[model samples]
Target: MGRKTPKSKEKLDKRKEEKALLAEHTALVNKANSQTNPLSSFPAFTKFSKNGLDVTLDCKRVADMDESLIHSIFNLEKENMKNLYDECSWGWNDKKKMEEMTEEAARYLMAKNEAGELVAFSHFRFDLDYGDPVLYCYELQLKQEVRRKGLGKFMMQVLELIAFTSNLHKVILTVLKHNPAAVEFYKALKYEVDETSPQNSVFEEECHYEILSKLNKKIFKT
Candidate 1:
């Protein structure tokens, strides 16, 4: 036998109905948004494949990349990642972790060769600090063979297009002090460094980062 008061019984019934209605409403809203807007779904995946180069805006697909090519870029194994971790010291994440991180990142660009071998990759996350949305590039790398071939600029243009199409206000990236070439590249593209270091800036580990931003004229045009 169970003891139940009238007020408690009514409240419980009401709560159950509310929960069911809320779940149904959420499903309907999601379905309608997906149908109405393409971006609301899985965002967008754009690919640029030509002569010897192929560029794509995706991350999950990288896991399916050929093992041989992955090894050529950088060993996708834990042992090698450990060596990289020690050298980087900032703590590099594992493959599973990197995949997860990349998924959360809103935008990514991967450059591959004619053989479908990934040569360069870049990952960016959307930041909303500047009223409108802006993308912040967190990681960018290219294999040796692909360097000095104007591929870097092509990747940057792809990233810029992604940001513009997404209606973002600007694109931002932080370049570490070690990479002089990247710094020069961004400078050539008119990206400026915002050097507002904190009071405790003497630490060697706290290397200076160049914060660069490029506005989206399409979205901001008057």
Candidate 2:
């Protein structure tokens, strides 16, 4: 798609249109990131009380978070994800994982139970991904006790709400193929294989993960 000769007006117009759309996508993502709190819009969504589970949810950047809680979530993530990560092309590296989780750009959506214990978390960021404004979910890990009480579903719903409310084009995540339960969970939530996901013909047996996304119906993705 290299431009050779500057000739036709149609080509010029197409280039202008593409540039304008890219600017809109970048601006939308920038605005979402500039917000004080992504969760601030929906106050009622901060609480989860259903199926005998009661907890409070809050979003904070990794820098503003307490050190202990950061470590706690890191431990929880390792507990829940290490083996799954190990079984795939991405073997778990403690230092690398920690660095990613604590990066300045990272934000956490944390859930705490009645006793004020950290139970589940979703690490996400609002940004321009693959030329689209998206809320990229890095991790969604829950403690064993909170696994099936609809808490995981609730947390995912919160992520979707945040993304759509901020006008992000979609919510995206990567899930390992070995984790059947997790794969099914996203499918149940109506997420489909994203265009960016790997093709079987390309990687064949080496491919270990799938990228999934749910689009904002309000936004038409180009």
Candidate with best TM-score:
2
lDDT of 1: 0.56
Which sections of candidate 1 miss by over 4 Å? Answer: 1-100, 194-207, 219-222
Name the lDDT value of residue 78 in candidate 1. Answer: 36
Clashing pairs in 1: none
Q: Tens digits of per-residue lDDT for model 2 on 1-222? A: 875675766788899999999999999988988986788889999999999899999999888998899999999999999999888779999999999999888999999999999999999998888899999999999999888889889999999999998899999999898999899899989999999998888546767898999999887754
Q: Pick the candidate with the highest lDDT.
A: 2
Query: Each model's TM-score, in the order given?
Result: 0.56, 0.93
Superposed Cα deviation of residue 2, candidate 2 (Å): 19
- Residue pairs with colliding backbones in model 2 are none
TM-score of 1: 0.56
Distance from true location, Cα of 191 in model 2, Å: 0.7
